[model samples]
Target: MSPERFARINQMLDNRQIDLTVCLDKVHKTNNIAAVIRSADCVGIHQIHAVWPDIDMRVSGNTASGSQQWVKTIKHYRFEEAEQAFNAQNMQILTTTFSDTAVDYRDIDYTKPTAIVMGNERDGTSPEAIAAASQHILIPMIGMVQSLNVSVAAALVMYEAQRQRQLANMYGTRKLDHAYCQTMLFEQGHPVYAKACRRKQIPYPSIDEQGQIVASTEWWQRMRAPDPQALTC
Candidate 1:
């Protein structure tokens, strides 16, 4: 709640890049969910729409860390709750499955508003959830195992989303649109950070209007005024 803490929250929000959301469809294992959260943050995603019928955190552990401080994780009591949330935002959902219509993960157009639904560790997304998905994606494998750990699969696909968004200059000219950036900035860190930045006279991280971190800030406004109350925590 202190300005210092608020500023740090803002910093995390500024750095988030992917607009991708990960849906842990009935993911019961805490470790898997936690690991996925860590992975989501690693790739700069700021929002995670998870279907946690029972929001258990012991398994996720530090994997979620202070991410919720920066990442605005939306919780859905039902799988459909998760679906409606994203669909309302016009974000297309991408599910990991081997349906006849499945596309290679690499082929998905990550630049668009996107969400990925990762089903249970034991059983993948339910047929109902998949039916609601905007599209289906699958990671090709040479081994007998059809998929990697949910966290690993997320990392692979998310990076590609980052890559495609980059190609589109999601940071340069196109930039993260204002809505996504601001929502991320607001969630990643504390809301008070914005006031802290103004008080500290610091150049808040290089954020697009939407609050997404600009990959390169050579052209951004450079300022680093210390928080007036930096001496106080």
Candidate 2:
């Protein structure tokens, strides 16, 4: 990669919010999903969880504007699976819903490990999702519409989290651990080589300061060899 491109990637990785993420529950609209991914990228969120049991989690490239390529999206067939994964990471689930117990979205502590859950375009948040949430938050609406589109709402909530995190100096330095940063940098900068290493069941080669792979020719030859276990099969 060019020095400028490498520097840009390094800067983005440095500012990535590892503790913050967004979860979509059955959000099927392509445009909305694309918009959410775009907003997530803009806010420096590295990961996004999607739970759509009945439909494939597909977003439009046009609407996503290449933002989807930067964000890591994990798809779950069920809400329970997604919830468990986030819980395992010690992240607090904050669901957006219209309920008596729901508070303003800005009231929560975004500087902490958080996963904001957004619901479907039509039904809002599901009961199970709401029940699973650690907190219920909503964007106040005084106009007749009462609610905004899922994408718009997600952008609002994500930017609010960004704003809070910024004030806390979370964006001033690298938050992601060294191992994850290295892995992500290598994967993003040399995706084809990384995928080849995965296929060969070998560890990824180290990357230089300029994002160039720093592996010996012998190592490359070894990595190209068929896996012994697969050969036995």
| Top of the candidates by lDDT | 2
TM-score of each: 0.68, 0.86
lDDT of 2 by residue, 1-233 (tens): 66877888899988889889999998989999999999999999988999978655679999999988788889988889989988888999999998899999989999889999999988888888899999999999989997999999999999999999889989958877777777877887878777777877778777777788788898889777877768889
lDDT of 1 by residue, 1-233 (tens): 34564565455545565556788788777777777777777667767877877655344557777555545567788988887888787889898888999999998888888888888888888997889878889999999877798878877887888788767866433235566555445434434655555575544454454434454343233223444476586
**Which ranges of candidate 2 are over 4 A from the true structure?**
177-179, 191-203, 220-233
RMSD of 2: 3.7
Question: Can you tell me which runs of candidate 1 are displaced by over 4 Å?
Answer: 1-11, 55-59, 172-233
Prediction 2 global C-alpha lDDT: 0.88
